[model samples]
Target chain A: MVSRAGVDEIRAILDGVRDPEMPALSITDLGIVREIRQEDDTVVVALTPTYSGCPATRVIQDDVVRALHENGIESVRVEVRLAPAWSTDWLTPRGRERLREFGIAPPSGIVDGPVVVSVACPRCGSFATRERSHFGSTPCKALYRCDVCLEPFEYVKPH
Target chain B: MRDSARIEYVLRFGDGALVLAQRLCAWVAHAPVMEEDVAVANVSLDLFGQARMWLSYAGELEGAGRDEDRLAFHRDAREFHNVLLVERPNGDFADTTVRGYFYDLWASLALSELAGSHDERIAAIAQKSRKENAYHLRRSQDWIVRLGDGTQESHARVTRAVDELWRYTGELFIGDDVDAVAVGDGFGFAPEALREPWLERVRATFAQATLDVPPDTWMQRGGKQGVHTEDLGYLLAEMQVLPRSMPEAVW
Candidate 1:
């Protein structure tokens, strides 16, 4: 059985792994890493993708595996689980902050709710922003424009 | 027999998604606007992802040596089980939008019900897929309303597209032996149960768009039973040509 300390070390290693698409945030910050547990001698990392169709999922999984191996962990397994579906609410406070700093509006409101809370512009911090398109640079984002600054930005749509 | 029924049920979902994704991909560079191009492509990618999940799960249930690629590429036209609406040719921008609108509504409702499935795997996939389908429905519905209510020409075009496609929509909710087995097992819902809600929403959307709902006249059927329109053969020929020719090639 692997020690609890070993699991913590593995997690710390994961913390250094950044999302390929959103490099400003770690996978943990994005809430993709569902669990980290030891099965016998192997460290198994369970991950849930942000969206079922998000293309970054496969890349993120590979990064997780590579991150563990580079950290002196030879026996590592990565499992992708779809249960309980991922929610934007899982975005860490730090993750939301990083997204703001990166000029992308973080998701707001409940996953399945119809009420869309107006997203503030990350550029000029203006409340007067409008959606340009439901799709943005990636599958997880929507294109929005700041009326004040005239800057077009991406808003990570709440899943 | 039970496993086969499960596989069939899953394949129905997967095939519908795959064919629709292929149709949507055809619109990538051909959309009327850049924003719409991106939107359609994103929706297509989402359906492709769903197709991968469902087909992969179906392969696992089948327990034969088959996987997603094998089922997707190796199967002939007669073996595919997608609804006829998806495989129809993309007649125009309005036609594509209407097709997507109809399918998205059905898919959204079906996935919502499937989220409550007794099988954990199916429930999980359904839960994940339902979120994406919501976004898809929103996109399609928005375009449909825009075209249906925009102007004389635009409204007329969308109306014609709606009428042309109405017959194909009936096949979506007709249950068969495979559906019966799945419903009995608590892993699936009878497609019949979804029609009322589906039509209600369709009617509301049409009302908002200022478009009349096409009469539910004699509905065309048979895509569910591996019987498809000639269009599916052409679609498969285009989609499967590369894989068929270069069987050993890797992407």
Candidate 2:
């Protein structure tokens, strides 16, 4: 089993990559990094899509390979899994904060958890946004039009 | 509206999804372009996932205790309800595009109406599905126009696919067997009305693509009553074998 420090190191190494749309947020923060396994002479990273069928998968994969190589780690294999599904619930607080700073609202509240407040807009800090469509931008986020800012944004659907 | 009829209806929808999904998977390596392949494959996966949900639900209705695998695999060619369009071989990317565009047009309307069905279960499923179908419809329509208008080769090929597949278009609007149970119990939206809007959408897209809207003449109709084209039988054979052979394997 990989130690906690090893995971921390991996996380640090992964920081080199950011959500291409929301540049401030790292891939790990976006909740795409599902697991990391260390074998005899290799490191294998497993990931779940942000939503079921996000278009950014190829870009993210390339980023993963580039980042791992930059860290002087060879023999790295990235595996993409669909089971158990990925949800916006996986977004970290820092990630959410970063998404807002990037002009895209980070998903708010918990999915499959206790009833929570509705998502707030990162632009004007309003919860008055209305959902326009479920499949938006890339297919992972639902499009919402913020009445306050009169702008459209993507909301990560809770898995 | 016996249990079997319901199961068949569900299977037809599911089978259509699964079959198209298999064809879409073929593009994983040979997509005309890079991004187009991923988008097509992803949409195909969405359809397959929907198929699993519908078939599993059908099994429950059948009370045969069969799951998705049994419904997907154990069934004979005669049992499938999918239209001929999905089973038609993918001759080229244009053929696939035309097929997808045709299906998306129908599915978008079908799911929208189903979202309001009297059956709470189907309605719930439709609600989730309409979202994806809407995306499929939008993306496919966009591509149809792009290909239909793009170049000499694409224009010629896309038009041919549309002409070849146009005969199958009328079958989607028939709403025959579906009328038996789809709206009998409750919130089933009238299937007949959807045809006109679908036609309008088709016309708009075809016009945008500058392609002729072939007359809706001599339409091929049958799948709703379990009658399918020859190609469907072979598709069923390939799709059903693994589940039938294994008997109880879970993956």
Candidate 3:
């Protein structure tokens, strides 16, 4: 079992971590964390991203190090996991609700399953949203515009 | 055409990337030079990743219960839609240079066109793949000229490879059902517009490589319809057998 202190440290350190573009939220809130393990004095944090070509990876890594260092943990290693590819469905319940409130639609379908359903537009309660582009502001999100509101939004393809 | 065509189109591009990646991977431990070897491996990884995306998307488009792995492994050689140029066995270093030269010229423009695809998925893949293609093109261009102008032996080898692969270049721009689906859905545009830049780049590269450019003669086309050389059978056998054998296998 992980020590209470270790868990709390992780939570504390991660609290300061903000996404490069969406600064108001932390990665923990984004649901990018897959697992965490500690061996000796080394902390290995395994992470998955919504997409492989995430441009903000460097910033995320830097923030991870900064957060840990400030808490007296200087030699932490942040390892990235490529398998079990992240899906937007990983977004936390609160994150999804927050996204809806922020005027951005939450993910439409469950990525792990095969059932396809129409995506709903957050701006307007319409099933008429369409994807405008696969690559968005960051590599992970796709560009989508709601036909109802006609407002283009950045969708977080949750990791 | 049915949505199945869309799946095939995605597969064709994916198989092209996967096959090329396999060939490039061959140079991982045996590149002509150390740095070049590492670069080749890195490029191979990128190609492999792109292949995964294309195959995955193709599977989704097909809605036939096949994911990336099944699509990759279960398909027979005749079922694959990759062009002959990519499947051409990697020869000497000069041969490799020529192969890359031909591909980069077409890929540079194909990706640029794809970046604007009406289909968001294709466009997204295009956006990322285009950046990689840009670098790959530059790298190939640098070497094309260097090898083309290098010693007599290097020049001759590169020239031979270029000539042999020229016939296959026509297959790149031919559109089919998948193109239709993407276009019909208002997600992409005609790939024919890519021919000009592709041709210009090819002409420039050939000049720099010290290789005489092949005349804009009548070109043969067929791969877009899935007709491939006999060699593809052996290749598919190796690339797909394990996955086919262990159908449910997953890590």
lDDT of all the models against the reference?
0.90, 0.75, 0.72
Estimate, for each residue in B156-212, the C-alpha lDDT of model 2 and write its tens digit: 999999899899888777766466565675545555787889888889998999899
RMSD of candidate 3 to the truth, in angstroms, is: 16.1
Query: Model 3: per-residue lDDT, tens digit, B14-132?
Result: 88888888788888779876557755765676677778778888888887788877777887777887877888788888788778778877777776777777667887776667656
Off by over 4 Å in 3: A1-159
**DockQ-better candidate, 1 vs 2:** 1
Model 2, span A11-40: residue lDDT tens: 888877887766788888888898988887
Tell me the deviation in Å of residue B48 in model 3.
Answer: 0.6
Candidates sorted on TM-score, descending: 1, 2, 3
Candidate 2 wrongly placed segments (more than 4 Å): A1-95, A98-159
* Candidate 2, chain B, TM-score (2 decimals): 0.93
Q: Candidate 1 residues A50-79, lDDT tens each?
A: 877778888888888898888788988899
In model 1, how large is the Cα lDDT of residue B57?
94
Q: In candidate 1, which residue pairs clash?
A: none
lDDT of 3 at B241: 78
List candidate 1 segments past 4 Å from native: A112-114
List TM-scores of chain B, every candidate: 0.98, 0.93, 0.92
Q: What's model 3's TM-score?
A: 0.63
Please provide, for model 1 over B194-228, each residue's C-alpha lDDT reduced to its tens digit, 9 standing for 90 to 100: 99999999999999999999876999899988999
